[model samples]
Target: MKKIIVLLLFFITTVTKSQNELGSWNIINVNMKIDSKINVFTEAQLRSLSFYNQFHYYEFKAGVSYKINPNFSVTSGIGSYNTYSEGGDFELPMKNKEIRSWFQINMKNPLQFITFEHRYRAEQRFTSNGYRNRFRYRIGATMPLNGKKIVPKSFYLSVWDELFFTDKEPYFERNRLFVGGGYEFNKKIAFQMGYIYQFDYKINDESGRDFLNIALLYNFDLTKKEEKEFTPATTD
Candidate 1:
């Protein structure tokens, strides 16, 4: 459809645009399973309950930052990170709702930074016929190359491998991979995104497994601390 083409171009532009100052993630993705058995978690979760099929999915996630140090911080809050069914009759194919949380440990070097990041999630999975309960975990790293140490204008890149854990009462265990990153505008704002290329699995819509992810973080100063401003000396 025309809309799909527009969206594709939107993602392409979003990724290449360096001036995007949004303090959140805005990732665009185009995938084709890259592998078979596409949605591992969905298949396991809905193995016994039949209502969905193979299809594609798209998602978006945004959050705020809590700076612990120049190189360290904790991100908390909410964002839109969940799984929806492929082309179907029902409007509510929202089988998974991701409650986002992450802890990032950074190592600041001379011209760049290395981060060992862990993303934890509590997901609400829905069955084709009824409702179900499930959870997923993602652990990865983001490596960023800072343009300037004092006033960072742009960032290079980062990537990571993920191991997804799930207990499918209906099926078996499944795994996946998540790779992505973004550029920082300041300590309070940023723009970035990622993609999830899935492996061996099955679902009503396999496309749902291959998704685009966007992340934005905003830091609000809760505690106010006043600092003395510099005063110019005058001749007596």
Candidate 2:
């Protein structure tokens, strides 16, 4: 399709522009459906200023999600986040060591082959510097390239923009924009890679950076053995 080709070209162009300064952002996510309305999930991230080198940041988190309806869900999570100096691989004298807890809400609207998603989150951060409160919102859309829905062997495209703010003066904090695509290998596994541009206001540790984002997602259903319709995992 003409639209698909245009999108692909845009993706390639953007990545090419930032290739020289691109950082690495990698994630692993696992989700398990424990009941009809409850799910448990865990995620980990590792990041570097270069392609697998100059490692600087990492985080691990686990949470529970409750589906309130077909269109809405709520989640709560806690995580350990660490950031190191940028010169070496996780160098000494970490810049920031943080324990973060967050509450989030998600809403979805599906139209034909595309789904529009909205996410809102509030975070309580306990960091080496001090305690802080932050809020974020993201709007995203996903479209299946090969089928009406994301199923086994399907390919999909996703794009999102997120804004972050804090409670103090100069409240506007950061912005993140992501564009990427993924392939569904089966009902349980999928892999995604994309480009992300992040901009921070007056933040010194993790400021403006272009990242190559890669993620692996796994989903499991514990209640039944029968195969069901696949639901693609969403990332932040």
Candidate 3:
């Protein structure tokens, strides 16, 4: 009986020491089309810990994308991020800010029931500490649950996996997996809510900061209206 009691105590202690917190990430994104082949996108995010009590970070990003064709596009972006330290018994909030510039390429394939997308991005980061570079790749798929496409009044499922790599110490940075459901209000507006699981190599010991991710997206088209084709004057 005593041996079993000791083992139980050890197990409980290990679990308590490794406990992690859950967080929330909320974002708003907008995309505007400049023409048939070009677009601009903007995003803002609020990230929090402890169910929105403890503020964690804020991020703003803007980018331009050029569609090479229906299936492929390239993007370049710049972002500013401010991160705060988690508050605790003796800890105080301090801000660490970073600026990042990135470029990405994306490819898409459409199937009967699902669409698959692949993205590759490279980033150059500037921070108070120093400069760093990182690379990331993500594979994602979306399927409509109620309609043929993610059209108005349609519900959809989205799933993705992303890997992060860096040139700094611990070359492997992190990995993320997300599963979500979204509703398309129209071609211009949509909302998604999901859960994201992230594995961080820098933070050892399964820091289970799995997050609730929420996003509101808006899309706009700015393409110039096509002019009517020139008509030849009819000769009487």
Candidate 4:
């Protein structure tokens, strides 16, 4: 059929132009609760172009979150990124930086055997080149491997797919697919390691990259108790 021919040609062209590269992404995230409805978080990341070396970039972010219910939450965050050349070159004309602000909404759904999270995000970016805006959506699912729930001391499987879009001519930006597993150390900390496949589209070419993803997550609660005023005793 005509459609089959077009599909075959597309696959052939993609395979011929594909340049596979390996990279690593490391993340640390901490969340602190201010009250039942409010929370804050900080995150940092180190990215590399090689297995464990050849530094690529670093990012820092801070954010506040508000919980609407058990299943829904909203967050606003600001981030700074410093990026170098592919081989860790930081010389002039090879380095760039960006500042970005984002807002996101997250929702959770419980299924029979798997739990799913839906995230919608919008970003305002100020890059070395200019300003841009993007929107993203991701759907993630987790299933317990050794227990009924993803509780402490349990391992779970995690998978997600995300897509990015812009408002320009080529509205489609990028896509990411991830598969990984996490082990909950306790109620407050956890670790996840996985692999990510990223596909990016440009004006005339497309590229594919593979990444090793590593993450550490920390959670704590410090909700304020009832407010009270203290009266000092007056001497007579």
Using lDDT as the measure, the top candidate is: 2
Cα lDDT for residue 45, candidate 3: 85
| Model 3 agreement with the true structure over 77-131: per-residue lDDT tens digits | 9988777666732124444568999999989898988889889999988875578
- Compared with the true structure, all predictions reach lDDT values of 0.37, 0.85, 0.70, 0.71
Q: What is the C-alpha RMSD of each candidate to the true structure, in Å?
A: 15.4, 2.3, 13.1, 12.6
Off by over 4 Å in 2: 1-14, 18-20, 225-228
lDDT tens readout by residue for model 4, 1-236: 53344345334422343456567778888887788788888889887766677766788999898989977999899988777766553323446678999999989897767888889999998888678888999998887666667777767777789998988868998998877667777767888767777888872211346777778888776764532211010000
Give a tens-digit lDDT track for model 2, residues 1-236: 73476368446835686235778899999998898789999999999987789999999999999999978999999999999987899987898999999999999998998999999999999999899999999999988888899889888888899999999967998999988878889989998878888989986557478888889999898987654566666545
Worst lDDT 10-window in candidate 4? 227-236
Deviation (Å) of 195 in candidate 2:
0.3
Which lDDT tens digits does candidate 1 get at residues 1-236? 43344345446633453432211223332111111212001111111011233322334433333445443434333333445543442235566554433332323233235445444444444434344343445545545444322123444244544444446543423456545545556544455555444443443323323434454433222233321110010000
Candidate 4 segments exceeding 4 Å error: 1-19, 89-92, 203-208, 224-236
Q: How accurate is candidate 4 locally (lDDT)?
A: 0.71
Give the TM-score comparing model 3 with the true structure, all chains together.
0.82
TM-score of each: 0.45, 0.93, 0.82, 0.82
